[model samples]
Target: MKKLIYLLFFSFLTSCSSFSEYSKETKKGFDEEDRTMVSNEAANLKTITFGDFKFATSQKEFRKLNKQKPQFKEILFYAKTTDVPYEYYVLHNPKEVIKNESFTYKDTIIGNSRFVIAVSKNAPRQDSEFIKKMVLSLR
Candidate 1:
């Protein structure tokens, strides 16, 4: 009886230790991925100040803003509209040097300037006012 109890206790301790190690490794992997995403976004972004908030702004300012990190070759600057469900985007080249389509506005050729564009889609409406303000600021 004594040996059986001791074996059960040892097994429990070993399982607990293994689970703890697995949890730590999973968390470390997630942290590394987040860092990599941030680094990639920074490398591709030509300008951080798309809307009212800048990526380099203070942490408090970032908390009050509504923007997403650069992803899928597009940087979303603001929230999507409810009526149309559209979000503003600033497209960028994925590669180091690649000639792409020039940014345009109302059929006018805006050259290769990286400008804001409204894309139709289902997105959260968190920063509508800020997006409008930014567009107005551009005009």
Candidate 2:
């Protein structure tokens, strides 16, 4: 009876440890692809300041539009109506509004729903020249 109890306890302990290890691995995998900032290579960056939130650099301001662009293709944001200082917000497709994890950034606060139009992350990051141009075009 004593040996049987010991075996059961050991088995339970091993199982708990294995479960934790598996959880850790899964979390790591999620973060590997989970990004919240666009890469520094997207093209067509146009700088239009809105309110107190000033995105000075075209590249820096891109983040204001798309939190984390995984590639050159489109990104999306649900913004407030008062967010953008220009008419570009009218260009967003109502259907393309993606699921933002309940985030309200400076851009969104102004009322512009954000979205990208480039190709998806199908090409190399270095070759994502499209993104780079967006960053550089903003004057």
Candidate 3:
């Protein structure tokens, strides 16, 4: 009976430790992917500013827009309707970027409910250039 109890306790302890190790590995995998995505996107940045927000896009896309109208009509509409300032509309692809839990930031929904604007006051310390641009615009 004593040996059976010891075996059960040992099994339980090992399971708990394994679970924690698994969780850590999973988190590390996510962080690595987030870093890669941010690096790639930031390298491709072609940006335009409206209010306090900086909009990022590929140079190819930026050239297609009518310079006068700026086709940010949806964005403009949301900006006018919401109490939030234009600068809050910083990130281009908010959904993907928001997955990085390491970066601390705030967000507001805008643009016909299709867009989210990410705001961060602290200078970005992480490798995400997109977040760096967002923080810089706050200054």
Candidate 4:
């Protein structure tokens, strides 16, 4: 009788531990799915706009359109005299920009305006088409 009870107890403990592991795995799956959904939604956004300010709007125009000062980090700047043809600035918010395989956001200033470009980091580095499109989109 004692041996039977011990066997039953061991079986119950094993089942409980298995169930705990299963629950953990199920929760992990759900979390991954949630992240994927959020990523997809972010990817679907084709335009970048902050309040009334939009990509390709001149700095002066931007100031007039937005009442509040916008926050961003400057990544690069190029002078008009340079071979680049346009005086540009690159800016980004490290917190909002995704550095992963999903996407990356870059703000490029050309002439007197700033342009926002989002590209998949996983894309081929040699692909100039995306850059051309972004530059052409600037007014």
Q: What lDDT is reached at residue 20 by model 2?
A: 13
Name the top lDDT candidate. 4
Supply candidate 2's per-residue lDDT for 128. 36
lDDT of each: 0.29, 0.28, 0.28, 0.30
For residues 1-139, write the lDDT of model 2, one tens digit per residue: 9999999999886443101111111110111334222222122223221222222122233455545432221322111112322111111223344433332112221123343333223333432342223322312
Candidate 2 vs candidate 3, TM-score winner? 3
How far residue 32's Cα lies from its native spot in candidate 1, in Å, is: 45
Off by over 4 Å in 1: 1-71, 74-76, 92-112, 116-118, 121-139
Candidate 1 clashing pairs? none
TM-score, every prediction: 0.22, 0.19, 0.21, 0.22
Model 4 bad stretches (over 4 Å): 1-101, 128-139
Candidate 3 stretches with Cα past 4 Å from truth are: 1-56, 59-89, 92-98, 118-139
RMSD of each: 16.4, 17.9, 19.1, 21.9
Model 2 segments more than 4 A misplaced:
1-91, 97-111, 129-139
| Residue 47 miss distance in model 1 (angstroms) | 14
